[model samples]
Target: MNEQDDDRDGGCGAGCGCGTPGREQFVSISRPSDAPSTAGAGATDRHTIEQAVIPAGTFVMGDSSGDRNAGDGEVPLHEVTLGSFSIDATSVTNDDFARFVDATGYATEAETFGFSAVFHLALAAPEEDILGQPPGTPWWFGVKGADWRHPGGRNSSLAGLGDHPVVHVSWNDVQAYCDWAGRRLPTEAEWEYAARGGLDQKKYPWGDEEPDAGGTWRANIWQGGFPGTNTLEDGYLTTAPVRTFEPNGYGLWQPIGNVWEWCADWFDPNYYRASPAANPTGPIRGGSRILRGGSYLCHISYCNRYRNSARSQNTPDSSMGNAGFRTVSR
Candidate 1:
């Protein structure tokens, strides 16, 4: 799509308020590219796909209990039915992302913008300077030079993080990669179904219990304070390897924590109330896309969207330090 068409359709475009001033205007999008495949002859061997078979059935969607503080969007938990489909067993890893980048030279929104919004604990600043940083729960700061390759910014590298879930990717970027791979982003129904791993109406992929099952770590999540103090009891302060945690019954790992995966649905909180009982696809159009799973940055003090029924939204063109995606094929 051309720049004008992209902006109109909310596809990938340059002026999405994501790029820095005076930087190159190249749009980091995941649209279909004519560029040759970068999946070298060896690339095929490096990647593996785990399938999650969702049976055709119906289940309740959204929070059964209401969040008094929640907006009107996520209301009236309703029923949704979905046909059988398969989903990736895990979030897309750095290695998988590297293949897409190699083939298309596809820069992520963060790469093109020259930085990304990173949690404060991930930043290096003097005690005094920390107080002067931009305010957002005192944890999120717009750090320049942060991307998938250099997650923590210029001084950081992905040398030891090749197995970690790829970050700094926008929904549009993930969609583009899926298209190139002859796959597609999973609809919200499909994602929730896969996330549940065949379970019905449970708070998490594993169950209602928190990841700290009897004082044992079940997934990678923020241990201490929301953005500042992370004890790292989970053995990670940031993103962990994609398969670092145990898989659910359907063999899906990190569906509740580690990183948020983009869904194909346009987010409308109350849409679930009026949604079809079978194969709901969300609203026809909206300002943002739906994101599933919570990231390591999630905390109960603030954003508790890590639950399987919990949902979040973001602009399709927006990229963040903890955003990535996986794919599903028919």
Candidate 2:
């Protein structure tokens, strides 16, 4: 077995509580050589992507619930106004990505790098195919042959996951998909506003109620214990179907949990301090890009970032099993 070190670009912010202090929400190795850029490759098929129109309006942005993790930059409780825009009804599914792949032949960064970070409990590949775990994040393992197609590991397949959100994709990879789909990632401000589901300053997309309110699971997340027991109380160990949960008032599905959705802005913890009042796109430049919504691995004990105003980020080239993206109308 070839043991690999966690050669990452930087440490994770304090937002995602993934057990390890200051570790990234997902592990990312060194980036491979760049693949040919594929922007503006084709026009978007409206039939393939269902969109929900978020009417133009202004709303207070950031963590109003006061449940924000320290240093997550989800504060200052600033006001933000955004123009009318349309967002994906659900995250990009495996079937959708497969169609994009079949049409573009574009290689994702994970495929280019030959591996991706997989949750240790969800490992499906043989022991021989296991690469190594990061230094502090024992819950995650760097598995060879892990990509969007093989989310669990080398032995996993997309047999019944056609409707599930595609995992193991990077910000850079989403750009290629956008080029082929003729869509762009939502700005951080836009993502927050739409995720609010027309509600103002609520803790979740469904108001202040907890995800497990009334013993009903509103989102897919770790149920039992972090990194050890899941109990599958939410009926999912890795990822649930993109459209499994009830849609928000805006008709957006599972905007707060499922998988981390990439946004079209560079991540800056202090961006909210000086964010523009209208359509604030994040920083002009930064090394890490913003990621919104939590993933299936999120738990109250470990990662409780599955809130409306919750935020996280990773390098543009990073890819992991708990991350994917949805697109906005260009």
Of the candidates shown, which would achieve the greatest lDDT relative to the real structure?
2
lDDT by residue (224-281, candidate 2, tens digit) is 8777988998899888999897999999999977888999999887877788888888
Write down the lDDT that model 1 would get. Answer: 0.67
Model 2: runs farther than 4 Å from truth?
A: 1-39
Clashing residue pairs in candidate 1 (N, C-alpha, C atoms within 3 angstroms): 30-176, 38-103, 73-269, 73-270, 81-277, 120-139
Among the numbered candidates, top TM-score falls to: 2
Q: Pick out the ten consecutive residues of candidate 1 with the lowest summed lDDT.
A: 1-10
What clash count does candidate 1 reach? 6
117 Cα displacement, candidate 2 (Å): 0.4
Which segments of model 1 are wrong by more than 4 Å? 1-47, 65-69, 124-134
lDDT tens readout by residue for model 1, 81-177: 7887778888888888898788678777666655565556666433332212232233455566777887766667879888788988878678667
Weakest lDDT window of 10 consecutive positions for candidate 2: 1-10
Candidate 2: deviation at residue 76, Å?
0.3
RMSD, every candidate, angstroms: 8.5, 7.0
* Pairs in steric clash, model 2: none
